[model samples]
Target: MATPTITLVTAVPNPATFGQSVTLTATVIPLGAGTPTGTVTFTITGGPILTGTLSGGTTSVVASGLSAGVHPVVATYSGDNNFLSSTGSTVIAVVHASTTTSVVSTPDPSTLGAPVTFTATVTPVAPGAGAPTGTMTFVIGGSGGGLFTQPVTAGVATLTLSTLGIGTHPVVAIYSGDASFLPSSGTDTHTVIPAS
Candidate 1:
């Protein structure tokens, strides 16, 4: 007859940020005697399925790219010849990372009909790593100016314009955050003078 066995599972960094790596461990214990040997399969809800080989009744796997929410995890131990199979479960929570946006314009005070380039940069707050991806919206001169959208590449977005009447214009750069980062915006002002 096969010996009865029990499995237990745990997650390191229980509350993790989206796209952050997490370690999952599983331990299998035999009811009677002797250590349980074999492999353990981990099934993560909304994540990937991983297999780990047991060493001294314990095994671990590293996973990442989980969305911002609670995810269920299951560990199934493939019992050895003398032990019976067992399963264990756990949960992990992932939160969105905060971000900041800054905007700058080349030649802030420029002459009318002169080319002006506006650049926006997006960066993660503290305790977060990796570049943020998404779209950036450029709002020129409040509501009467114009609105333009550009894709964020390497955490930076830029726009250029040359048709400004002759006055001070307020410029805003809004970042449309992705699955891992939160949205943010930055503002600046540009003064346009009459051509010589």
Candidate 2:
């Protein structure tokens, strides 16, 4: 009779971001013996406990929706008939994700040479996540039409154009990323028709 020992291997990406999904993999190894099979339970501190069936001695699970902080994760292998149970652990740090950028152009269809205001709003992922401060590049009618920059104040930036070509213009607003927040952009269309 041979005494079987099991070794557990766990892998997870560290320094993750909030609302980011990551795959956690665990492998079970049997020392000087045959293959190991069964289920592996992955427990994440301040998160959820997930279980996955072992396929060819390997199992993986996707973990998401974690809060912003350091989370300790452990993988425990359920022993099969030929092997003993083992456990492995690791730590993951989740930071705040990038904020969202939403832009709106007033008077979508307006007469040429009229005033059009483009308002860009940057919203953080969660409340108290902090406001994003940077330059907002406003481009109208692609790259060649018009380009300008505005300072983001209190998660809001605005740009107004008094003159635009008489046609469909594609407006793009890009928010320059800052520390603690990633860059984001938004697009909208403004139609300028001929005056009566």
Candidate 3:
């Protein structure tokens, strides 16, 4: 019996920024053994799952809408009675200067089922020394999703929407960028009223 080694199979981009998905993937290689027989379980010690799977000593998952912070991961494998657990975790930091972040949404109701102008206005932050800048994506209805990677000028980023379905449609604006520069930070929710 030898130490079971597990490697991260998931690619970590940045977990600190808002709307940034956290995916953890890893491959397990059982040393000094024949045909690894056991169940490999993946668990986010303190985060959410975005997308992933566990099978034949492989695990993966994605975490979404998670606040900025250091998140730990744990992978455990059971062997007979004595559980062989591996403690290999990563850190997830949410970028933000202050504890409270200001976010405003401006959803246009004129162009329902069509492209409309979507705006996300993030008010002056507490630590206003540096403002969050980068890509702010807009997803409307259930199918129409758009991208706006313009810098945040005057605390505003206008996202363009192509089309939205009828009825009350919910819209979300997520700010993504270099999380290391600024931890998990983003704006509030925006809504769109379908055409009558």
Candidate 4:
């Protein structure tokens, strides 16, 4: 008389997408002279267009091709070939490729040097949520954004260029995303209120 043993392998992706490869391995192996052979079947759980019957082994299939986006790869083994064997299964998720971030510049204030506030937003081209996790650099007249780095409760960002000298001071805000998102200002002015 013999007893049937089976174990499931966790820590695997679900519903793997198309155009990807996956591997199935056995786990929760009991300590003993367990029979290391039997009839193992590999199939996509709850998925269509996937079929195959594989042999038994501790670990099989270096990598198998699949469609994409979370393909469940199951590996099963029959314990009849050995004195004691455990049925094991694993799943792997395969997903499509991700494209690079595509961010554009928002309309900045035309005038430069003026004590005008502005907000530079970065948007990704992909159909996802949340803003791109990156830094938005704000530079002013060959100098760092001293106070510009200040946080804004709302969504808008403010840039204040104090009344320095005169000339056409260039007040620009550069957004730092993947590479660099620089939305510059044309030419804001700093009207020097004549000191009486």
**Model 3 over residues 1-196: C-alpha lDDT tens digits?**
3455544444366534544665666665655453344454555645643333436656666665555466666655444332244534455655543322234444444446555665665543342234455555554445454444556554456755555554454555655543323423444444445556
Off by over 4 Å in 2: 1-6, 100-120, 123-196
lDDT for position 9 in model 3: 45
Q: Flag clash pairs in model 1.
A: none
For all candidates, what are the clash counts?
A: 0, 0, 21, 22
lDDT of each: 0.90, 0.79, 0.50, 0.40
Query: What is the TM-score of candidate 1?
Result: 0.83
Q: Which is better, 2 or 3, measured by TM-score?
A: 2
What are the per-residue Cα lDDT tens digits for candidate 4 across 1-196?
4445564544323433233344455543434544444545555554432322333434444344443445455655555544355555555655443223221222232233335444544443332122333444454553322324533221234444443343333444443332212222222322332233
Q: For model 2, how does the per-residue alpha-carbon lDDT over 79-133 read when each residue is reduced to its tens digit? A: 8777788888787787766778888888888777778889999887752255678
How accurate locally is residue 125 in candidate 4, as Cα lDDT from 0 to 100? 32
Query: Predictions ranked by lDDT, top down?
Result: 1, 2, 3, 4
Error of 3 at 107 (Å): 17
Clashes of 2: 0
The most accurate candidate by lDDT is 1
In order, what is each prediction's RMSD in angstroms? 2.7, 8.1, 14.7, 11.8
Clashes of 3: 21
Q: Scored by Cα lDDT, where does model 4 land?
A: 0.40
TM-score computed on alpha carbons, candidate 2: 0.54
Instruction: Give RMSD (Å) of candidate 3 vs. truth.
Output: 14.7
